[model samples]
Target: MAAAGPGSAEGTTGQSALAAHLAFRSAIGDVSGSTRRLSGELSRLEASTPGIAGRASGLFVRYVDHGVLQLRWMDAELAAATQLANAASEVKDPDMQLALLRRAGPRLQAAMMGSLLLAVWLDFLHLTDVALKQHIYSVEWLFVDLDRVQKMLKPAMTALSSGESGQVEAVARDIPALVGHLTREFAATREAMRAGAEKLQKILVLKESIEAITLLSALKFSLPSLPPSAPALLGMSLTVGGDGVMMGTRLVVSAEWVEMMRHLVRAGVLSLPTVSAAVRIQAGQVMMAQSHDELPKGVCDALGDGPEVQGMHVTGRAGAGMNEPPRHHILPKEFREWFEKRGFTGEMDIDQFCVKMEQANHEAIHGGGNWKLGRTWPGEWNRMILEALQKAETRTGRMLTRNEILDIVAERMEEYYIPLKFIPWRGP
Candidate 1:
């Protein structure tokens, strides 16, 4: 067989590199599509259950935003690499072709690492989605358990307080068994939530590890060669082969990276903050119920006697306290005409729909004083609510009912993290 010429050799190398590049690009595309789908699913889940999916929603927002930047950078680098590879394929000179291919190596490696980081990110998203759903289901069951226990206890306590001997004797006997059942169910649910949190923590650690690797790879591609002193500055080895060949390049994690990881692990950085918040909220609810039960009957009755303002039983006089904030209309009074045209024509006076909030928070909602809430603030929220109303009307080709409008308002309020208590009470 005739010996292969320089052209033939260049053709083989270029073809191989180009094929690899195409495969990596294809993988990136597949992963990108998966991320988008997963993100949409997470968003819908959040929409359905606002505060329940807070942790997962926060992570998705943060990482997806970061991923966008990384992917863009990777795409640009890979495209440049492909161009270099193509250039090498056309050139007949052996040394020039090698130089071009060498230059392309770092870009390819950086892009490859970026793609892997995204794959890890995709796994994180999937795990978070599963974990969030499980937690929500478990928490819902816990609430059910609490409700059942409360229902069982209330009548027994009432019987005891009212001095009804027969009713007391009847319920007292069942109390022990009921308490035992609640204890078992609550313990099991707590265990499940704990396990789910641990899983999330593990995935969070894995994500960080991959991020570190990706960052080091990027440094390698950008710097190509680091002096001996560079290790101290970057806290990682950034050396490559003398001939500029990136194949078989070894990256040594610096002491700093290991120590930083240790610190984060020790600090419980991997623990989901939102999960902890949910647990605290649940605990607070139980405490609140207990406190309410402990209140004197007269006080309980008095609580209900507070003057009704905008459908809320205002327990405290508006001007009784220092620096009392005035009540603000939920739907801005200025927009009353606009809202009436769409569906605010219910029996309840539009002006009376108000919620008492802090002066700063109230002002922030109305686009006052350095409002920096981005797309979720007064401006975007206003647009969103109006659009929702418009869409609802268009779909039915009729104005919305009072309840329907309130439902829309509630959803938007939750979406923007406004307190749900601010929504005017619907009559029983």
Candidate 2:
């Protein structure tokens, strides 16, 4: 979950921290293990960007925040990577394990750090316009370095196999050290990334940190004086020693997803803002005040229907959700830049666009407001899109050209930009 996707424009530091962890994870493994603690994370998201399924800050921040779960996810991934690396070290074929270790480990370390840095930059909400490019470059370097080292290991392995086990042992001694060397290089990248991020975070005056317990500070828990602070929204499970004092460690514990849900409900009480959250405090007093249950309507609306992941698309296709790849195109500029500038030029796949449009409409048409488990977050998200488009349409205060709006939105989605729902800039 790249922080730039959609939703959180604020892109909390929590998001940055998580992205750092996720960056590490992508090289290591899947994000689901960290998802084990979603209940608490979801509650935090709701508190920060309520009704995101309805009206979100922006796509970038939304994804950034959604990525906080990735930090915890890193706990599991770090554990797995460390274990695998350790096992590879112990193998009788030290040469074989060393090869695997060198090939995959360094790149994983490098790319993950790069991601973490990007997340930090995003959370600060600087020129994502810049980060868009920087992120790709930094991560690209990660893979480049990784592939280089992995490729080197092949020849090294070939040489070792021609010798005795003592030679293999000699090479094995260097395995961890070589991997550590890569790790050191990754750390340097991480530092450079941090500098870039520090530069980025400097650009914005962010809102107060929203916590699951504090919800939103504006939406106070009580009628009058709201709690002054957004206490740390405790992780659903207080602790899990996933990494076990090696590689790196962080708290990640497993709990029933349902239990996690209950944690959100309780934490929700604390999360209420001084104003609107105050309304919920009164319970029945403020029907206008959106309640926890009321949170569902907009959420249901957003998760309407679509594939969860999507790929990059240089060529514009209006309805493509993420998982799909960018249609083949060789433009002078990247699709992201063209998109940020409110321009789209090059060959687009119209047939695929029509199919995606039909699919999106069908989901909106048939699925109506059906939400699966843990998907409450997406409903308001879709509403954010629908409403933003509707709002953008209304704001122009004229009979706008349909083709124009569609073109802008199609570009926005293509670049994986943020919560503008649709595009904010109306082309001339």
lDDT tens readout by residue for model 2, 1-428: 55443345424423433333333333344323323334344444444433222232334444434345334434443454455444333333322233223322322332233232223222222222223323322434443543454454443343333222223323332332233333344334444554655566722221122122123211122222212242332111112223211111321112232122222112211011111111222121122222222322211122121221011111122221224322211111223343334323221212112211233433442244353431344433333344455566688885434334443444434343221111111112
What is the Å distance of residue 228 in model 1 from its true position?
35
Which portions of model 1 miss their true places by more than 4 Å? 1-60, 136-428
TM-score of each: 0.25, 0.20
**Candidate 2, which segments miss by more than 4 Å at Cα?**
1-43, 50-62, 65-83, 93-97, 125-428
Best by TM-score: 1
Query: Which tens-of-lDDT digit does each residue in 331-385 have in candidate 1?
Result: 7665788778754553234543555577777656556644355335535545566
In terms of lDDT, the best-performing candidate is: 1
Task: Please give the CA lDDT of all the candidate structures.
Answer: 0.41, 0.30
